[model samples]
Target: MVTRIAKCTCGQLQIVVEGEPLGVGVCHCFACQSRTGSVFAALAAFSPDYRVSGRATDYIRTGDQGARFRFRFCPVCGSNLYHTEEGEEHRSVAVAVGAFADPDFPPPQDSVYDCRRHRWVKLPDGVTVYEKDPE
Candidate 1:
């Protein structure tokens, strides 16, 4: 089993994920853009086979689709570590890819909410693009 660690910028909160990610993707939705303070947000979803250390603050957000997500971020540095869907029996935790800080990490295979993607931004070839969230 391959283990990888993802931590907040201040090293306050950390997550250790076992095995490979279930899915790696980028979201161009406005909510993601605002949450990451970047044009888009890159994330990797992994199963519950992960562990977390240190305390984190939680912020619950309701998505465009009305799905609620509980964002867990470092209370000190305020770096978002991961988020999980609520009330859906969701078993996957989506971690911010940037927190991994590995340039060699796997590239994103899916791009969602492409309709809001910046025109100047180009995605890797062969990525599955969705104009909006796939319901």
Candidate 2:
């Protein structure tokens, strides 16, 4: 089994996950761009089988479709760490790929909200593209 660890900037919060991720993707929705302060947000989804350590502060926001996601960030450095959808907090999690700071982390395999993707941003070849999230 493979294990990977992601930590916040201040090292005040961490996540440990064993095994490969369910998916790795980039989101270009306006909300995601705003949340990440980047053109897109990269994240890796994992099964419920993971562990979290240290303290974090959470913020919940409702997506345009009404689904709510709770984002947890390190209180010490304000680094966004992870998030989970409402009612799925214990069944799944999405961690920020940048939080890992691993050059070897798997590349994004999917792209969501491509309708909002910046024209200057080019996705890697072979990526599964979606104009919007899959329903």
Candidate 3:
């Protein structure tokens, strides 16, 4: 599979993702809302080998499993890049789907942490929905 790249608005940060994402989804969960200051967050899952260029800052958050997930983004424009499990061993990343420069990016396959999804908001039909983070 061919790798695709996504870059920050200022081109300061670029991420080269290997192949397609494992999944993509919108998270209406409160955590996402608070973090993004929006109703929902769109995410694209990728491999940990995802290569990122440009300086980034990390904000570690304790996930539902108590494992710290490090969110990395460009320090310049604050463009959210990817989230990862701490330690250099994990093999996956969840990229911010909105970061894609391509206007034709694929849609999400599932919605997670829906138990905390905003009641006023509604996801579209046909995608998998999970009350909590899907295992």
Tell me, by lDDT, which candidate is best: 1
- Tell me model 2's lDDT, rounded to 2 decimals: 0.92
Writing each residue's lDDT as its tens digit, candidate 3 over 11-121 gives 898889888788789887677787776888898888777788888888988877677878887889877777887874376788777778677898778998888877887
* Higher-TM-score candidate of 1 and 3: 1
Task: For each candidate in turn, give its C-alpha RMSD to the true structure in angstroms.
Answer: 1.0, 1.0, 1.9
Top-TM-score structure, candidate number: 1
How many clashes (backbone N, Cα, C below 3 Å) per candidate? 0, 0, 1
Displacement of residue 24 (Cα, Å) in model 2 is 0.3
Clashing pairs for model 2 are: none
Better of 1 and 2 by TM-score: 1
Shift of residue 95 alpha carbon in model 2, Å: 0.5
lDDT of 1 by residue, 37-116 (tens): 99999999998878999999999999888999999989999899999999653588899999999999899999999999
Position 116, candidate 1: lDDT: 100
Tally clashes: model 3: 1
The CA lDDT at 97 in model 2 is: 97
Cα lDDT of model 2 by residue, 8-107, tens digit: 9989899998889899999999998998899999999998788999999999999877889999989899899999999877778999999888998999
Clashing pairs in 3: 24-108
- Residue 98, model 1, lDDT: 94
Cα deviation of 93 in candidate 1 (Å)?
Answer: 0.6
